[model samples]
Target: MFQKIFRSYINSFSDLRREVWLLAFITFINRAGTMVIPFLSLYLTKSRGFSLEEVGWILTFFGLGSVAGSWVGGKLVDSIGHYKTMTASLLLSAVLFVLLQFPVSFWSICAGIFLVMLVADAFRPAVFVAISAYSKPENRTRSVTLIRLAINLGFSAGPAVGGLIIANSGYSGLFWVDGITCFLAGLLLLKLLHPKKAKENVKEVNLNPQAVLNDKPYLLFIGAMILFGFIFIQYFSTMPLYYSEVHLLPESDIGLLLGINGFLIFLLEMPLIKYMETKNSSALQNVILGTFLVAISFLVLNLTGWIGALLVGMLFMTIGEMIAFPFSNTFALKRAERGKQGSYMALYSIAFSISHIFGHNSGMQLIGEFGFNLTWYIMVFLGVVACALILWLIRILKKEAVSYSSTPIL
Candidate 1:
């Protein structure tokens, strides 16, 4: 029985190339030291003596920068190529991370965060483009899922280690570790990852970013993604603040709870996603279900304040995330003709950026004004709307589905 399960596990990773695996390793390394930002809210409020409103504005700037970065990176990847964009973003972000560690005022911190988020996240679109370029269509979602597996495994380690680091060496230590790891990842990519890997089939599709914008169905889908992103981001932003403020949980305890999310994703996501893919569930269906699960995850929190309840809610959210994101990414990328992958993926990254901006900033205000329960209630309502929007996108895409009906899908 154990052998059968092990074979099943290995089968989930089949059909991917070496380049895909290499990218996953790079992602794992990059994410492993991503500890500073998760704790940034508490650091700003408790240690830096900023108000929740102030932190909201600060994080909003980060989101704005990420949006800009995604656009720039996507363009650069298409123009100069992914290799240069990937290397530059990582190296530049390393410097930015170090600069952000300096003692600074509110405005200075905001500026630092903006630049850091911009440079740091610029690599995202490039990574997405690379994955699409390197993998076969049949293996696309699996490639994304495997890379996400690396990220989640790293996340599982980063926060737990971050709690200890913050406890011992303070917030500055978090920045130092993050900076060093990012720099190392850049160097490794330059050394091991090849630009040629991302060059496959690029000449086949239109290179214009405008071409992506012209697709009505794709645009609607991107819009829905922003809604999904808004809900998903609360896990990283408002959820922490709410837990710390209401439960009075220590950073270590909060870290543990967050770690559970990554741990669960690492353990269960691949097999679950494989099953869903095998069962031939539509990506839209998966995304809608995932969105609803996330809504339920938050709604359940309203029932009780116990730590156990929060953990259970987190488990639900992680499962939702596992189902929704990889398939959603694959779904969107399917719309891109070959040369437009970078541009398409770049636009896709913007949805999440908007989420970070709107979700974090607005969630802070809502919690401050009305309180946590009401804020969660509103989130549940939005999730319902998001589910509907996704379904609408499905109807729009169905017009074009006839051409794609012959292909095996995620």
Candidate 2:
């Protein structure tokens, strides 16, 4: 039975094109080196002596930079192609990450964080465009899931390794590793995926090529995503602090706990996504279900102060993330016209960027002022709001005779 189950799981990943697998591998390499983000708030407070409020401000700057990066990256993909845009973003981001290690003062660190994210996040929209170019329409969501699987696999390793590196060599080590990986990922992409060849092979369909601004339903979907992102990003920005301050877990334990989130996604998400695809569930329905689960994950924390609650909460959060993100991505990609894909994806990436702007800073301030319980309640409330917005988006799409199911509207 176990062998059969394992084979079934393996089969879920089969049938994707070779380029899709290569993209997933590249994403894994890049994401594996993402050690700095999971530990950044801790580094600021424990090492640099920044107040919670100060960290909030710094993270807000990071969001602003992400917004800029997503916009520019989307435009660059439209004009220059995803290959060149991705290569430049990764190489430039590597340099910025290394430079960030030297900044110490409050403003300097804020500036440094902003600059680093600006370049790093440009990779988001460009990669989305690349995935669209690489995968068949029928398997697009699974392709996104495969890439997400790689990201989670990398994340599972990164935090545990980051904790060990911090224990031995300090936060400086994280910057160096992150920089090297970015550089290496860029080089690998350049060597394996030539721009001219990639452009020649891209299969274009007869999409509407409409301006993204004209798509009101999509804009509403973006609004819903922003709210969802606001709720979800709290796990990254403030939950680590919650683990440290309230639970009194050490950095190593915290890393392991965070690692569990990625581990769970790595193990379960692909099979789950494959199963969901078979059910022919609408993307908005899955998104609503995922949003509710995320809200409940936070509410679980309020049920008890026990360490087991944290484990339970993480499980819910991970499942919710696995359900929501790939569908959200597939929805955005499907909504775009062929020529306007970059603009559509950029706006999609920007929704999360906007969430980061408000999500991290507001979460930090809420915890600092009102405590963790209140913040969790607020997140739950926001999750409900996001669900309502998605429902509204669904109604609009239905009225327009647009399909938002496993099948693409086109």
Candidate 3:
């Protein structure tokens, strides 16, 4: 029994390249500093004196910048190469985080958050392209999952400590600590990741400017991503507020719950993914099933007001996230041609960015007016629609795969 468990673990972890491991380290470092996001609502409401509605709009602006940044980052990565783009973006975000600490007025705060996200979120596309560039084709999903493991490990620490940071040093401490970590991550990437060496493994990047937009099937997949993404964004956006304001849980309690989210991903995700990969699970199956789980997680919140229920709900949500996020990324990689990987990833990323534009507003408004029950039900409805769209997207992807295979070279 012990040997089988050990073998399963080894099988799930083996076969990743050295470059993939280094990139995972950078991911872990980058995510370790992720204190600002989980606590941003509390920071805004308690420290900055913003109302819920105002914070919603400002975060929405941040999302708008994120959308533009993801698109631009893809083009930039394709142009300048992934290493330079990622390092530059991370360093720039560090500077912006410091600048954000100086803000007094609302518009300044808004502009600061928007600019910070524009710089920071650009890192997403570069990392995705790098992971694809570094991993073998068969191992891409696990490569991404390994990176997520690092991220969740860091996440497990960031917030739990961040609650204590808030207690000891106040909001300014969060910003400074976050900024310093960003700087450290950027520096580590510069020292460690040799892009020229890794690029040799993957094919030469395609520099065709309009290549990604021409794919109709990929476009529809992005549409479906956006629908489900709106709900996913709540994890970072309004969910913390629900715990803090509605349930009246302390920040420490919220952090512990989110830590549960991280631990679940860390402990279970890779093994389950390995099992699924063995069974030949389709990407669309991951997306659709994950969407159903996300819907159920939200509905669980409404079914009970107990703290245990929140933990159970988060466990469900974390499982869905582990399944959905990795597969969606690998799905984009399969659909993209070489060199266009960055653009495909950027477009895939925009689904979440676009969702942020309205996700917070809708959640906050519905809760403020109608109440949490209605808000959760609406999330359930959207999840069902997102699953339906993914089903349609699966058909489109299958048709394209067949067409590509059937075409004979003359």
Candidate 4:
């Protein structure tokens, strides 16, 4: 049975073998470099010596930069080819990575992180554009899932390696490691995915904002994603602190917890996504249920002290993420017009970047003032709001479905 399933999966990718492998490899390497950033606060405070407020500022700066990058990348993908935009961004990011390794002042570090995020995050929309451009709609969702799997696999390795590097050589080592990996990955993409020029007939599609941003349903979905992102950003910012303060998990154990979360995503996300696909579940329902599970998981974490309990909370959180993310991407792709997939996905990407600018700092401040339990409850409240938005989006989509179905493709 297992062999049969494996064979079936292989058969599904027969046409997309080259594109899938190229994307997978690129995703893995790029994500491996992500390790240097997420753990950056730990590096700053624990190693280079910075305050919590400073960390928040740096993150906020990075977020602001990413917001701009997302927009620019989307537009560039519409105008230029995906390979060109992605290569430029990735190559620039590699240079920025090296700059970040410099033993600079706190202000310099903030500037470096912001610049890197701006340039590096630009690759995100380019990647989504490439996937949409390369694959037929029938295979797009699965292709995205494969890329996500590679991301998780790379992430699993990145943190463990990051932790070990930090433990031995400090934060500088982390940046240097990230720099080397990013440089290598960027070169690989440039060499392998030699992008062709944009076709003239598709130029009209590129001009339509309605294709990406004008629809009511899509806007509603973005609203929901923004709220979801706010709560989710806590995983990086506040969750580690909560573990340290309330649960009394040591620093090493916290790293292990995050590693376990990444590992589970690597192992289970693809299979779970495949299973969900078989069930014909709608995207809206998945978003609602997933956000609910994530919120509930936080509540459980607030009450539990045992490592087992924490792991269980993370399990539920991962489940929620796995369900929501791919479905969200697929839904966005469907909602977008032909050739505007990059713009749509880039708008979706805004959620995380926006969350970083406001979400983490806000949560951290709330925790600083009100305490961990209150902060967790606030996250739950945000999740509830996200659910409401998802439901609203579903209604909007249902209303538009018939109208769109009858309309001629422009």
Candidate 5:
């Protein structure tokens, strides 16, 4: 029954092949491993005896490393091809995971985390770029949605399992399980993905690291994504801490909230994209609405006693996310130069890694002293700022649309 439903959904979309579906499966395994780290700040500071400030710094290092990875990963995709770059990244990341399991000095752990992030971050852009490359132009948004759906599904399951493991077996279990999953993901990539390397001249013609940054419209989109990412990243850091410390909620319930969050994505994302096609909304409009919803979701945390209120807020927040993400990718791809999609996508991803580190580290400090309520207030403010940027992007896009329409058709 499940297989039949899956086939039906795949058939509903154009240009989705067996290979893309297989790649999605591999991405799921890769992300499931990545999910283990979201709880690491809590583990390191609360359970493992690292100072809160130190944990924040370590997280920052990981983020900084990811920024570097995004740039290098883009070049690697052009040079070695997506399949090889992904395979190398996965294998190296698995090795780093094992290295992390050993008892090491704080500086050593920091260094290790940095290296791990550098390699692991490498796989993500290549994966997304490959999705864009393989997908038919008309079905591009749906392809991106499938990638996100895979990520959401992995994240949903991984955290519930991580929470249980942390509760029972501790941090060691999280590391071991995640490490194994990383290796498994690599093996899957090895067997399934065999993309040929770009020819030297074609690679040279298409991939330009500077092209992504220089394109005025694309840069505007990147700025919006960065701001949006900063606001969204608070969930991993500030939101969880709010539940655990400020609200004095049971840890299990926090896990349940995360589970609900993930489940909603798994169920709603692809369907939402399909429905949006019928509604005929512009991608920019969807992005604007989604950011607004995410901002408002933080307001619910102020209601201390009303769990139902919090749930309502989360539902709306998820709605915003479902609308925003797939369209964001589509917009970026649309603006990207022919053959330079990987470079643009990699640069776009850098925004997330950069914002996440900033949000998480800064959020830790805010939550520690000012309390969770104030943190949410701050996050709401950032969300507003992000919305303003998106509005500006809309204006820029309008001018571009008019200009393009005035041009001679091919």
Candidate 6:
């Protein structure tokens, strides 16, 4: 039975094109080196002696840069194609990451963080466009899930390794490693996905491509995603501080705890996405469910101070993430007409980037002023709001005669 189950799991990942696998592989390399952001707040407070509010302000700059980067990246993809945009963003961001290590003053670090992320996050929209280009429409959601699995797998390794690096060589080590891996990922992409080869693979058909701004249903969907992103980003920002301050966990333990989210997603998400696809469930329905689960995950943290509460909360959050993200991604890609994918994905990436602008800062400020319980409650409330938006969006899509099946809406 175990062997059969394992075979089934393996089968879920089969049938994807080679380019899709290559994309996933390079994403793993890049993300595996992403060790700094998770520990930024901790580094500021423990090492640099910044107050929580100060950390909030710094992260707010990070978000602003991300928002700009995503927008520019999207435009670049539409103009130059995903290949060049991704290559440049990766290489440029690598240099920025290394340069970021030297800034010591509060304002200097804030400027540095903003600059690094501006270049770094440009990769998001480009990669999304690349995924759409690389994968078949039928299995696109699974392809997204596959890339997410790579990201989670990298994340699972990054934090644990980051913790060890910090213990031995300090936070500066994270910057160097992150830079090196990003540079390597760029080189790999250049070598494997040459523009001439990529062009041969993609068959573009412009099907009455609607301007993203005028698509009311999609606009509402973006609004819902913004709320979802706001609540979800806390895991990377303030939640680590929660683990450190309230639970009194050391950095190594905190890294392991954070790693659990990625590990669970890597282990379970692909099979779960495959199962969901078979059910022919609407993406919005899954997103609604995911939003509610995330809300409950935060509420679980309030149930008790026991370490088990943290574990339970992490489990709930990870499941919510596994359910929501890929489907939401697939929905956005499907909603776009072929030629306009870059713009549509850029807006989607921007929604999350906008969340970064407010999500981290608000959580930090709230915790500093009101404590963790209140912040968690606020996140749950926001999650409920996000669900309502998605429900409204579902009604609009239904009115438009959009089918909820896996079929593309072109």
Give the per-residue lDDT of model 1 (tens digit) for 48-150. 9999889878978878889989988888887877778889998998888877888569999988888888888889989987887788777788889998899
Q: What C-alpha RMSD separates each model from the true structure?
A: 3.1, 3.0, 3.8, 3.9, 4.4, 3.0
Off by over 4 Å in 6: 41-54, 104-106, 163-173, 196-204, 240-256, 301-309, 367-374, 403-410
**Per-prediction TM-score:** 0.88, 0.88, 0.87, 0.86, 0.84, 0.88
Candidate 2 lDDT, 338-383, residue by residue in tens: 3488888999999988997888778988999999999999999999
Give the distance in Å from residue 225's predicted Cα in candidate 3 to where it truly belongs: 1.1
Better of 2 and 3 by lDDT: 2
| Model 5 per-residue lDDT at 312 | 76
List pairs with backbone clashes in candidate 4.
Answer: none
Question: Which residues of candidate 3, in runs, are more than 4 Å off?
Answer: 45-47, 166-168, 204-210, 235-257, 299-312, 401-410
Worst 10 residues of 4 by lDDT: 401-410
Model 1 per-residue lDDT at 199: 69
Q: Candidate 3, residues 1-410: lDDT per residue as tens digits?
A: 98999888887988889889998988887887868887887888998899988987777777888998898888888778788989999898888886787987889888888888889888989998898788987788899999989888887778878889889999899889888889999998989887876865666445663477787777888887887888887876578888887899999999788778777888789888888787645777887888889888999998888878888889889888888888888778766663377788899888888887877777777888977778888888988898888888777666655432122100
Clashes of 4: 0
Give the residue spans of candidate 1 off by over 4 A.
42-53, 163-173, 198-203, 207-210, 240-256, 301-312, 368-371, 408-410
Residue pairs clashing, model 5 = none
Alpha-carbon local distance difference test for all models = 0.82, 0.87, 0.82, 0.76, 0.75, 0.86
For model 4, the stretches where C-alpha displacement exceeds 4 angstroms are: 1-16, 42-49, 163-176, 196-213, 302-308, 402-410
Query: What would the per-residue lDDT of candidate 4 be over residues 254-300, giving only the tens digit for each residue?
Result: 98887777778766677676666566567668778889988888888
Clashes of 3: 2
Which one wins on lDDT? 2
